[model samples]
Target: MADNDNRDHNRRDRDDRRRNADGGRPRSGGSGQRGYGADRGGNERRDWGSKERRGEGGDRRSYGDRDSRGGDRQDRRRDDRRSSGDRDNRRGDSRGDSRDNRGGRRPTGARYGQRGDDFTGGPRSGPVRQGFREERMDRRAAEPDLPEGLDLADLDPLVRQDLRVLSKDNAEAVGKHILMAAELVDDAPELALQHARAAKNRAGRVAVAREVNGITAYRAGEWKEALSELRAARRIGGGPGMLALMADCERGLGRPEKAIELSRSEEVAQLDREAAVEFAIVIAGARHDMGQHESAVLTVERMNPDRKDDSFSGLRLAYAYADALAQAGRTEEARDWFAHVVAKDEDEWTDAAERLEALD
Candidate 1:
């Protein structure tokens, strides 16, 4: 009986040792002791098995023992890191190879007023620029002398004073050219135009320079140049004085519609008698251009050209009226006007006698 009791005590000691090795808790019916499964302070502690399955508890470094879902999370992190590295490498490549941002290169190709590198035709050096400037100076220095028999005494004092805006030498050059232009305008219109152009190159902003240039251009049959210079003159000196010439230039350009439009400005009403007559003649010409011959005759009739006025403009207006009347098939009235023009045209400036003879 003593040996039996000793054997039973040894068995109990071994059982207690096994329980202490597990968790130092008392054993239940079958399993040893439920670790972290008991309620403590109304909260059940998480089990070690569940934490190990999630790979988040005490065995955090045990990647080999991780479940399939944890393994997928690891793979996703690796892919994200690789993708971010690829994006950084692409940005570095763009910065390295884009020539526009490298080596002090401009992003927008060439700068303003600078020619591009592809042009291979011209010698675009500093010597070329200097040569152009020197050539221009030489041409200006060699401007032609004023013609002989040209009168400067009759030039308007105000017109001479206006030339003073230039340098002393330039003012003298421009003044002589202007005087020559005025003297030669009626006889040598092309030479007058050249002088006017020279004066304009020196003092273009002067109203009288622009006016002389316009008149010379008109007489030389340069309608566009005449209109441009006349417009400049009118802009500087606002008056009805240049409107007739501008309308005439428009007519010369075959823009009779524009001529008629300009002739109807409020300035026309305030023109002096001669200018009004000239403007009326341009309007009549514009009407004639549009195949409105009777309207042309009527336009000149409004001027009331008569024997009382023996002026050159009066004779020109009368001749214009007669020409329009003849164009409109009014023969008798045209014959009477031709006789009137023949009576007043003392210098025989018009061919009215031949026109009347043709009518007879």
Candidate 2:
């Protein structure tokens, strides 16, 4: 009986030691103190064997709450990573939205003089806007070849003064072209026109450049171009000096009625003596073009063509009068006036000498 009791006590001590080694949990398929089939305060412990079989490790309480604390820390770390990723996604989305709001994509092949946003894809800041303007100005028209050693100082002082609005380099280039146009106007009128066009392209706002271009175009027989340039110059400069040329351009364009209209404008009375004489010549020519021979004759007669004056204007007036009389069928009177014009026209400005020969 004593041996059986000792054996039972030793067996209980072995089971307790095994439970302590297994973290004080009951062994599987055994009933011992605090066994799996036992209840603690009417609540059974969780089945750790089933949990381990299902890959859930074991009860967190069995290992002194290590798994519970570790799981909570890991869960917090995972939540932090998820939140950080969400913030990054939001930032990326906002950047895309900003790009769309700015103006999406830039237009391809946008030309010069177009709006600034067409090329930039958005509203330009100050430096960018100024750069775009410079690019527009740099896209200049075709320019003529400038002669070597040509002096910008040779340009008229008044014209140079007008070019002060331009940059120094641009003014110098424009002045050189204007001087070349003036030099070649009467001799190589077509080449003069190219130079004047170059000057006008560089200094379009300058009235003298437009005026020179108009005169060069007139000499080149580009009547319509001459009319347009003269009109632009008149609008910018506000003067009557080019009124006669404008009237002549009207005549050249087959608008003799328009020429007559220009002759009667208030600007006519403001013309200088030379311009007035030239205006009279153009008006008489307009009358002749309209087949009003007597009216044409009277137009030049009002200018008082005199042999004693002998000036350039006087010579041109007398020649016009003689031609008008010839057109009016007053043969003897025309012959007499033509003879007088030939005597005074030493500069040979008129075809009066030829008219006299034709009459004879």
TM-score of each: 0.60, 0.62
Which stretches of model 2 miss by more than 4 angstroms?
1-141
TM-score computed on alpha carbons, candidate 2: 0.62
Q: Which ten residues in a row have the lowest lDDT in candidate 2?
A: 62-71
Model 1 segments more than 4 A misplaced: 1-139, 147-154
Q: What are the per-residue Cα lDDT tens digits for candidate 2 across 17-95?
A: 7765555543332322232223444334332222332243443232112222122333354566556556666666554
CA displacement after TM-score superposition, residue 252 of candidate 2 (Å): 1.4
Error in Å for residue 18 of model 2: 99
Q: How accurate locally is residue 295 in candidate 1, as Cα lDDT from 0 to 100? A: 93
lDDT of 2 at 326: 96
